[model samples]
Target: MDFEEDLANDSEGALLEGTGKVASNLSDREEILQSLDSIHSQINQELNTIGQAIEHVDAEELPNDIEEFSVGLSDYGAELSQFIDEYRHNLSAQSEYFETLSSEEADFADITDGIENVNETHRAMNAHWYELEDTLISMQEILANFEMPTPQEEGE
Candidate 1:
């Protein structure tokens, strides 16, 4: 092939490779969002279950300190649940943004902008995840301070 033809062919190959990478990235992001949705659902379910259990607890039978602890647990559970819901909402918004970008006949600059938005979303998500992790660790510490009676002793 002539030099011009060879250069043209190389450019085409590179363009195709770039497009392929973008498509792959889109697929990966979709998968991550789906997984997040699934996790959010599971967390919501567990939180609801815990709330139900707390509701069933006989408040009058609990020691004053334990009763106060139960209230705190319920409040924290509610706050955590709200945070999860907000995270899921943000994910949905990001998904919609991606969908809009993908459906458009975007140029390189538009695609670059989309990628930047995705990166920002990722950073925000990571930060939120870390915050949640820290909150969970704190909750664990709080629980560690509490002294629960053994089942056998409770039966006495």
Candidate 2:
């Protein structure tokens, strides 16, 4: 019989049931870890692009009143870049730990520990992202308050 049928036919005590559950948990956890890694990479790439854009902004070209806003944007971008680096480091370490668990027969405790680690990292990343979002919103409001020069006045 197939593995699923074998598992279903097992009339043993709770041991078989527990084993099947652990196997399922491991599979699900692995998929989540993989997805997290992919997301981390994408975020890092986008942050890099933002950093580049910030660097390209010409402070001298901005109106005197808005020059400070540009500086604040640069500072925020730098802080975000640093945070992303730290998050990536945490993700890499967790990935390595998960890899080690996979190489051996992990017990329930080990699986649980790995899952907890992933959850904690996710929480930390989410918190940092929220902070960044708030900063961006503030910047957007500041920009919205600035008066744009009319195209007809630009040539004069």
Candidate 3:
């Protein structure tokens, strides 16, 4: 082949290779999107469950009864915010290939950090839930005091 013809063939090969990579990347991104959608739905469902559990709770007494209920919720808010930040970082880190996206070098680091952050959030949320349960128990005890009338009242 003439020098120009050979050069033209090589350029075409390179273009084809790069186009393949772009297509592969788009497919990997779509998979990542699907996984994220499932996770988001699961989290939303869990949050809804928690909301339902707390729905009938009397919050009017919560301000006075639970010393740190508001503070605890604030801390939970911070943890959730941090989780979102890490999740954004993780999602932006995409793989170059469609087949091996999870193990790929491009996304491994961010994914690791994101998983850790998510794990931490799970732990924090669990602790907060227990804390809330304790608060509810205490409130129930306060309300239960009505079962025992004072001796003076009984005598009267």
All candidates' TM-scores?
0.48, 0.50, 0.29
Per-residue CA lDDT of candidate 1, range 17-117, in tens? 32334334545766765675565566566455444444554544444465455555566556556655665666556545544444336466765786687
Alpha-carbon runs more than 4 Å astray in model 1 = 1-64, 149-156
Compare candidates 1 and 2 on TM-score and give the better one. 2
Model 3 clash count equals 0
Top candidate when judged by lDDT against the true structure: 2
RMSD of each: 8.1, 9.1, 15.2
- Which stretches of candidate 2 lie above 4 Å from their native place? 1-64, 145-156
**Predicted candidate 3 versus true structure: per-residue lDDT over 1-156, tens digit per residue:** 232242244345421343344344445756754664565455455444334333544444222533343344444444544544554454343222222322324365654665466567557655755764575466457556523223334335
The 0-to-1 C-alpha lDDT of every candidate, in the order given, reads 0.55, 0.57, 0.44
The TM-score-based order of candidates, best leading, equals 2, 1, 3
Worst 10 residues of 1 by lDDT: 1-10
Compose the digit string of candidate 2's lDDT tens values, residues 1-50.
23344234334411244344434454565566566456546545544544
Ranking by lDDT: 2, 1, 3
TM-score of 1: 0.48
Q: Is candidate 2 or candidate 3 better by lDDT?
A: 2
Score candidate 3 by lDDT. 0.44
State the displacement of the C-alpha of residue 74, model 3, in Å, after optimal TM-score superposition: 12
